[model samples]
Target: MVGKRQSRREAVSEHKRELILDAARQIFAEEGLDGASLRAIAVRAGYTPAALYFHFESKEAMYAEVLHASLESLGSAVDQAVSRTKTPQQKLKAAALSFFQFYAANPRDLDLGFYLFRGGMKPAGLGHDRDVRLNAALEAALRPIAEAAIALGAPQERANLLMVDCFAHAAGLLLLLHTGRIRMFGASAPDLMEAYVDERIAQLVQE
Candidate 1:
């Protein structure tokens, strides 16, 4: 009974932590990291600033946690989509579409992961480690597709380069769409992504 009570308490703590992270993500997206304060996040999370400190040691820690959570969720979505499909080509296409769909569906999360946090300027300690892990997650998500392209007769180096280019293009397109800088074709970003994936897959398969 004591163990059960402890577990329940831990669960509640985790739930509250998640609430803090989510609130911080929204605040970061809207106001940028430098602009979003611990006090603001506490208000957003319906907690006192002291309560916020209990979950996160500092604003940077909270930001790191938010970025980690976003990457984990995105990585999970890509992994699930990759696992659901059989063929390498299908997996690649599905992964690409899944990535685009994730960003489109969760623009706020994307802004936190890709926009709010400057890549090269990531803090030197835990923040840097979190950034590395996030990059690894992204690379893992793309590995299956890169393997597929190589299996389809493209040179390994070329296939890897192509995969990188495709990711950059898709990410850039999404950013443009989000900022109202460009209107993507079709009703949704995924629809445009599907067509892009189809074309790229065909090119890689032929090469």
Candidate 2:
């Protein structure tokens, strides 16, 4: 009975932690990291500021967790898209499209990923260690695209370079989309992305 009660308490604690992280994602999207405060997150999560300390060491910790989850979710979507297609060319296209669609569909997530709404200068990340970890997550999410390129007969260096290009293009398009600038170009981000992917695939494979 004691063990059962302890397990129940742990489950409740975990639920609270998730709530905190959910609130953090939304708030971070709206305010960015420097603009967001522990009090704000705790208030949004319906807890006292002190209550947050029980679950997280600091706001940076929560930001890292939120970003990690966001990147992992993106990686999963890309992986699933890759799996759904048969040929390497198709897989490469699917991976890039999935990356764009993930951010385009969830503008809040894109904001969170880019740390939007900062009023002043912002470092690339919380610090060196956090940046390394976060970049690794970002890299893992984009790795399958390079892997698909390699499958299509591109050398490792070229495939990796192409993957970086895809990331740059996708992220730039997504930024234009969120800022309502894509309409000025008279082309949908998806259409532009498809054209880009089709050209890249053609360059690599004879199909």
Candidate 3:
């Protein structure tokens, strides 16, 4: 009976941790990192501040969790999209489009992932590993696309460089658009990203 009770308690604890994370995501999206406080997050999570600290040591820790979870989800989406395409060019385009679509669907997540650096929320520990793995996965997804483009009569080095450059540019552009720092084609951010990817892919294929 004691063992069963302990297992149930652990499950409850895990559920509360998830609740805190969900609440933190909502609070961070609504208030930004600097503006969101531990007290506010606790209230949002239906817990006392001390209860929140039981799961996360600090506001920074909670923020890190939110960012880590968001990025992991996005990375998985990119991986799935790339795996579905057979050709390198198609893979590249799919990866690009998948990334932009993620941001369009989760602007708050995009803001949390990319723009938080400017807000003084430096990620540490596992957060760093998450970022590195995410970037490497993206690069790996593009490699086949670059190789296929080269095999089809395109210049090898240029195709590889351009593919990396285009992916980086798209990520930066999404960040800028989300932060209201740039406008594109006078359309919604999603439309602008789609148009940009279309133009970029066309230029690459023609070259």
Best prediction by lDDT: 2
lDDT of each residue in 1-207, candidate 2, tens digit only: 999999999999999999999999888888888889999999999999999999999898899899888889999999999889998888899999999999999887787777533454444566677768888988988998899999999999999999999999998899888899999989798899889988998999973
Runs off by more than 4 Å, candidate 3: 120-164, 175-207
List, residue by residue over 1-207, the lDDT tens digit for candidate 1. Answer: 999999999999999999998899889888877778999999999999999877889888888777777777887888898889888788878777787778878887777766433545464434566667767877876676677777777788987886797688778778777887665443555566788889998877676
Give per-residue CA lDDT, model 3, range 1-207, as digits (tens): 999999999999999999999999999899877789999999999999999878988877787778767776777888788889887667767777787778767888777865436546574333565556555654654565466556546687877876676567667777777767765445466666667767767776676
Model 2: CA > 4 A from native: 116-122
Model 2, residue 187: displacement in angstroms? 1.8
Which residue pairs clash within candidate 3?
88-145
Model 2 TM: 0.92
Ranking according to lDDT, highest score first: 2, 1, 3
- Models 1 onward score TM values of 0.80, 0.92, 0.72
Computed on alpha carbons, the lDDT of every model, listed in order, comes to 0.78, 0.88, 0.74
Off by over 4 Å in 1: 1-5, 116-126, 184-192
* Residue 108 lDDT, candidate 2, scale 0-100: 76
| Distance from true location, Cα of 106 in model 2, Å | 0.7
Report the Cα lDDT for residue 15, model 3.
100
| Cand. 2 Cα-lDDT | 0.88
The alpha-carbon deviation from the true structure for residue 38 of candidate 1, after best TM-score superposition, in angstroms, is 0.2
For candidate 3, the 10 contiguous residues with the lowest summed lDDT are 118-127
